[model samples]
Target: MRIPFALAALTLLLGACTVSTGAEPEPTQVAGAVCDVPDDLRPARPYRIPQDEVAADVAVAFNMLAVSWSPQACRSGKDYPDARYQCAANQFGLTLHGLWPNGADNKHPRYCAAPGPAIAVETVRRHFCMIPSPSLQQHEWAAHGTCGWDSPEAYFAQAAKMWDGLNKPDLEAIPTQRLTAGAIRDAFVAANPGFPRDGVFIATTDGWFREARLCYSRDYRPMRCPRGLGAPDRERLKLAPKGVQQDAQRGVQTTG
Candidate 1:
């Protein structure tokens, strides 16, 4: 299903938005020097999946660019209205869904051990408007973050860098009239020079566009989507109305 950042100090450190519909996502704002990605970090490389494996094996994902539902949609009048998630959704639009790590086969590693929480609740408060929630932060770290980094701080710092580097399309500008998924994917390809056309995937419910995903290689470079992700480019697609309320558990799956 749908899935799942930062460090503070030797003794203490860890913390972390909100998502708005039809609005541009806010830039991540993190305080302290630790928030930056290390200059020496090595990037993951990409390779084409073998044809034989493509059919029998599960889709492989190195990293992904995902958008999440607004806090009001996820928490408003719900059994558990997470104040932190709501706070974040209110401040940001299309917040990061997750950065997942997967293999070519069915095996996917998740919820790995972490030395401690990725970010403290207070640190989470500092970037509440931009980050999704504390639970998401921890889940992402324990599941996907551990595969890419040794500590939550390093993983979060890199995530910030990835978000910063993305040349995402403007979802706010999606045309309301009849459109094809190809047109939607093209919008993204136009914005991101190196991004592959087949790499963009869509997720929706009853013709309402819920989220768009962008796949990346291990080294953080764009690559062709293996299969079974978004709609075919030529297929007709629909976008949800502006400010559309999403299901409470939006982004429950972590894969790209």
Candidate 2:
């Protein structure tokens, strides 16, 4: 499936741009992720993106780095065919959701402009490892990128740079019993010294780990979230193990 033509047109007119951890314990040091780009990958299909209150007109307050737990995202969408590339392999751990610009009082900008041209196929292929979904990447560019960036390339480049700068914790190594929202936050702070203790905002779905939204300054320095978003500190969390095929099908398990 291809992105809608209207969205594509908007994209052509404007290009542009665009997570967490805890520390109760020192998290296990895992090797950096190695993404195996798929040779047969295709562009994402059309997906609806909800409109929001503001657009490019809103003053940029702070930035947000949204990261999703791949297993949870995949498991939830396992029945859908579009999800195959990400869900079928179960090779991903955390993945980029998007970089967002926020305004005061919880009002964020979105769908800043109509969709322009479909994102360049090469651009989609380039970041497929980081986002895993072509449609999502395209949607992000249309919904949020237009507000802050002049082009798709610049938007994605900034997102990739921020994503690369992060030191992610290995969730698979943590015992389930210790996986509370606060524990996850602490692990992130431990992994990156300058990161504020309240910087990471844990998001969950039915108690399962969802996304981690980390707050940042306009210049991208770590900053405390204005108001904690998503699950609370003491909330118990569940996560599907990384790279385990069966775990993806059965959902998250509590095992040490």
Winning candidate number (lDDT): 2
Best by TM-score: 2
TM-scores for every candidate against the unseen true structure: 0.62, 0.77
Tens-digit lDDT track for model 2 on 1-256? 8999999866543422111023221222112444545556667554444443336567789999987777776666531213555655426777888898877765677767766777887888677767777767777787778888988889999998888678677776678898988888887788778999888988877888877889999999999899875677889988866653322332211110
User: RMSD of model 2, in Å?
Assistant: 13.3
Per-residue lDDT over 175-233 for candidate 1, one digit per residue giving the tens place of the 0 to 100 score: 65646677777877897787887777776545545556777887878877565566766
Measured on C-alpha atoms, candidate 1 has an lDDT of 0.51
| Range of the 10 consecutive residues with the lowest summed lDDT in candidate 1 | 37-46
Off by over 4 Å in 2: 1-34, 45-56, 78-81, 243-256
Cα RMSD for candidate 1?
13.1
Error of model 1, residue 56, in angstroms: 21
